[model samples]
Target chain A: MKELSLNILDIAMNSVGAGAKNIAIALDEDDDSLRIVIEDDGCGMTKEQVEKLSDPFYTTRTTRKVGLGVPLFKLAAEQTGGSLDIRSVPVSESEKEHGTKVTAVFNKKHIDHTPLGDLVSTMVTLIQGNPDIDFLFLHTVNGKSVRLSTAEMRKELGDVPLSNGEVLNWIKEYLTEQYKEIERL
Target chain B: MKDKVALREEGSAATRIVVGMATCGIAAGARPVLNTFVEEVSKAGLLDKVMVTQTGCIGICQYEPVVEVYTPSGKVTYVKVTPEKAKRIVEEHIKGGKVITEYTIGNK
Candidate 1:
């Protein structure tokens, strides 16, 4: 993934493929930590399924699914001296509303680099296009928050798909600008 | 300081092509597209005119192979791109300044 956001998108896509209707992402950046949480209401996995998810060869899907997304996320977290936690519930119990939550916490001081810009852009792209799905994103820097609602971008773009060239370019520029602002620090 | 500032300015002025070359993209045949762009730019001796870069994922896995071109003035994204289409992009868009509407995300 170009950034964490891309990784998030990949995982979120898996959730959707698993029949999720809602996905929530929250990012918190502070002097000491950088935290990311992605939650989805989809068909949750069984204990056996969750246990094998980290294996590169395990995938329940039919499409060339050599499951690497979760492993990669775990590696990314570990690289930053961070941790990853994942939990899932089956759809049968929740009536197709399976919930999965993944949290990663990084040591900001140790991991001096993270692709926050790409993360935000990816989130924006996925959230804007999937109107049937709702995504809530909250970004915090030292306790100050900057929020982006996919609902807001959808209204602003007026029927344009988030994947459209114009909208993608706009998101890219927006992300680039946000990174520039962060670089000043 | 002088050299750094000049380099930064030059970097921003160059045309860039970012190919989505991750697994999803590669499975959809982005490698050949990237190779073709590299070859065409080199053969045309327009190395300075364009720079080819690879990116992980564009988030639209369904679109599989994606290519984005960022000129000095505008950015264009082409989705579900193939090698033949990549050649057309190099010949038409990169060299001739015309967008291939059929392959562009805009057409979709």
Candidate 2:
């Protein structure tokens, strides 16, 4: 992906494919590094599936093989002297604890670090397709942070789908405002 | 897919344009194509007739950024679409009621 946010969307889609009812994506950025964590209470992968995550990372994401979800994200991180990790617990191990968490740390100072692209669009696109689930997004830059939760929006909108044009506009505006405030601080 | 079926239960429009948005699709520039389709549909006042939506990989990673348009006749898949082509699709296919056969998957 050209931006780290696109990678986040790709991996989050994997969570949705796993039948996750709740998904959380967070970004923590400091002076030297940016950390992205996407955690989902989905049907986790088996140990065998989890073990496949360590395949060698590539330098170029686009020309790499198609249909792969992880190696590309791993490449985005590792190219910047960063790392990626995945922890999954299958339902057979413990039904209550079955989920997957992907943590990717990017060395922001590195020249190869990909920029964080339009996250509002990414979130809106995700919600537009899957309005039935809950998505929680939190981004922290320096000490300031912004948070958005579809669960709370659902509480307010009742039966309205997030894909509704007006609702999506509201979401974009809301996040834009929050981001502006965060950046101004 | 189950997702499209669920979406249809709400109120199926006369036409729908679905964009592929999996890892491969996004890396291949699907987002801009998707946004353009949505914008063009709304711009041409065809929002009531055309529904713009997205889906995960359709197992055609080689043709990343695939777009599927479902009209009353049937579904037509367009491969390797870009924002520019997406505009013409909205204008010719959706608005003009003429299928752009050159851009369809069958063209190749």
What TM-score does each of the candidates earn? 0.58, 0.88
On TM-score, the candidate that comes out on top is 2
Q: What is the TM-score of chain B alone in each candidate?
A: 0.84, 0.88
Candidate 2: pairs in clash: none
Error of 2 at A99 (Å): 0.9
C-alpha-based local distance difference test score of model 1 = 0.67
The TM-scores of chain A alone, one per candidate, are: 0.76, 0.92
Clashes of 1: 2
Fraction of native Cα contacts kept in each candidate? 0.00, 0.36
After superposition, the stretches of candidate 2 with alpha carbons farther than 4 Å from their true spots are A56-67, B1-11, B44-48
Q: What's the CA RMSD for each of the models?
A: 12.1, 5.0
Best by DockQ: 2
- List candidate 1 stretches off by more than 4 Å: A60-66, A111-117, A127-132, A153-185, B1-108
Chain A of candidate 2 gets a TM-score of: 0.92
Distance from true location, Cα of A101 in model 1, Å: 1.3
Best model number under lDDT:
2
Model 1 DockQ vs. reference: 0.05
